[model samples]
Target: MRISKRNLILGIIAIILIIIISILLIKQFSKDEKPDIKVDEKKQDTLIYNTNVEGIANINNIYIYGMHLNLSGEVNTTSDISSIELVLFNKSDKKRYNLEYEYIDNKVKFYLSNKINEGIYLDEILKGEYQVLLKITSSDEVIRYYSLNNNTAYSYMDYYTITRNGKNNYIEISTLSTQMVIRVTEKTLPKDVYDITIDPGHGGDDPGAVKNDIYESYINLEVALKLKKELENLGLKVKITRTGDYNPGNIAGISPYGKGGRVAIGYETKSKLFLSVHSNNLPLYPQNNGVEIYTSTNNNKQLASLIASNIVKETKINYSSKKQDKVMNGVYVRNFTTSEINTFKREAKENNYKFYETINTKTQYYYVIRETGGIITGAYVDGRNKDYSANLYYNSNIGLDGYLIEMGYITNSNDLKILLNKKNQYAIAIKNAVKEYLNITN
Candidate 1:
């Protein structure tokens, strides 16, 4: 078969073109068959980079609680680290943050603040879960990623745990049984142990005052628990004397460290302020009702007044003011024989007690007032005579302020109604008073 040279050349070119198209079709088919091939290629790239890199950075024991983030671990590299920074992502809001850091002892601590940027505060960050990228800049940059949302176990880290030391709660992370503590706060916490001590009066065997099936001990504990929660929410550390129905032991003639017994707990916890919640009782006069606050001394009269005023204003309950001495002048004592009078007087002198047959008495004479230590009120003696003095001046000598709140008279039906029905309102009132007293803006 004789053919032209041009025809032969055209046939060769067509064959070459068909071969190229077939190769393209085979490659497209392979791609369709293995969709994950691209991912494998990317992983290969990462593996190669990691092997070539001499220095590696690691994030161990990452902890996020409240507004604080703690990162601990070592970055091993030949090159010195020039800078270290964090990139935080709010998964819910899709907002991102870039935080600079200074490392100490192979650990970095970051505080999230709105002052850092708009809506980047701890409260806002705590509103949702976040993911973080820790970037370490040396001769080359190394990134270690972590997530606050996941429970997935990683090789070098254990799940976080929470614990409380006295009043402050801490979120802790550990690696190989070594723990790193992360303190959560809106602002830097005070170095002092705690801001307030809430003493729930008359616990365990001592059920304070009991009337109409209402236990004052129960009421005191309930109110104290609520107050603790409220103050903690405000970022204040608060301690309670009895988490359950237990006392620290007696004080003086009173059990559980009678009089200033609670002061011992305050001292142990290093509490700055003390509050004893209690229910009042008037067995002689059932008509005596309303709220009364007894300060350990005159110094804390202002704190007492603040609490009293708030309760009265919120609940519309009467404020039971301390009575004046002249108000009870018309009252008289029984005419006793000389022998009987001598016996009573002898006992009174021995106890250094005053026989007051009248209504007027100093509220500060109570043991809780005299003994509760810390920044508290002074002992108040109603009379000038030392023999008849009721005040022990226990708290006053130390310049600590303590207050006993007589929430309401459990003996009076009217007061009982408010105490039982409006218990939460009373708590709120007390919380407001505490906020004002502490000068807390939030």
Candidate 2:
């Protein structure tokens, strides 16, 4: 207890040193505290961004040169998005078009400039699928991606149902191009319609079918003239392929054989129908006489059949004798070759095989049923497998209902007499058939 002053100071210094060591240890442990590692759990378990597209779109009318696509869609984001970009992929060429747009009012309108040289033709652009991809970035380092599968640009006109997982949404959009097809009633006398093209078949060197001295072409012209008179009386516009008993060259200036023959009549004008009149001659031995109607490959077969049936019914001709056949006659009639026939057969076989692959059935070979109009040849699928191979020629362009009427046989003397008489019962029968087919009451 009785210590010196120096000893007391040393003890106090030792105690101070001990206190400093403890404070240092406490600070070292405090540095290792990990700062509580506070983690704020996200309110939503999964951040999702739902996207939708809308509009009427058609690919056919789209011109790619200097053409831009306008994209507008609504996005529902679970969290605030920092940035968003739309990715458009052209499936045809495997090319991508990226467009960036700022978020506004929970929606975005994006425009992709077509100024870049893609070296893609407008026709090729119409043939491929287009995909729309949406990428969204959020503040929480979470990224959500959404994609829409739009194969054809023309499908934009219809409502698209998008189901993500189990959730359902709708999208409507339109492409820049669209194609429209208009058809008119056939076999009926032309009503007070505006545009019409009357085609008298087998002109010039192509005299269609001949029988004895009475050429099929001559009879065709006579009936066509009568039809023209009736059509003109109805206050309708009409263009005749031939007016008199002469060759196509005789039309002087307005005919196709003239200098401007390449220019197709009624092509620029909105023609509703093309009626080609002709008289068919069967084999001289059989003496088969009846009315037969033919339509272009791309024309509506149902309508053609209706007109043909009405003609047969009105004339009281033997339905059994008349070939109620759907033939690809239009294509073959133009020019028939062995190569073309083989190609057609091969395509038909492939289509048939594809169709039966999914189902169990045998394919049948029918000539007329297999051929489509030159334009619509691509749209024709083998009725067996539904596989598309070639398109019809007529379906490829803006087309109208075309009719080829075989009035009577010129080979038979009895048939010749009926056709020559202007007031013959055959003419009355034809008039009644026209009335029924056109649905004309008067």
Q: Using lDDT as the measure, which candidate wins?
A: 1
lDDT of each: 0.52, 0.42
Give candidates' CA RMSD values in order. 21.5, 27.9
Find the candidate with the highest TM-score and give its number: 1
Candidate 1 regions exceeding 4 Å error are 1-192, 251-255, 258-261, 321-363, 374-398
lDDT of 2: 0.42
Which lDDT tens digits does candidate 1 get at residues 1-442?
A: 9889999999999999999999999998998868688788556434322222233335443322112233344443333555555444332223445544445565553333222011122232332222343345564565433322222132232111111232332222222222111222323334535557788888766787889678888888888898888777777777787777765443224443323446556544445467888888887777877777765322414456788888888777886633531121111112234565466567767867674332222223454544453112223333334333333433322323466778888888888888887777777888888778655675
- lDDT string, candidate 2, 28-79, tens digits: 8877664533222121111111233232221222111111123334454546
Q: What does the lDDT read for residue 53 in candidate 1?
A: 24
- Candidate 2 TM-score versus the reference: 0.42
Instruction: Compute the lDDT of residue 319 as modeled in candidate 1.
Output: 69
lDDT of 2 at 297: 35
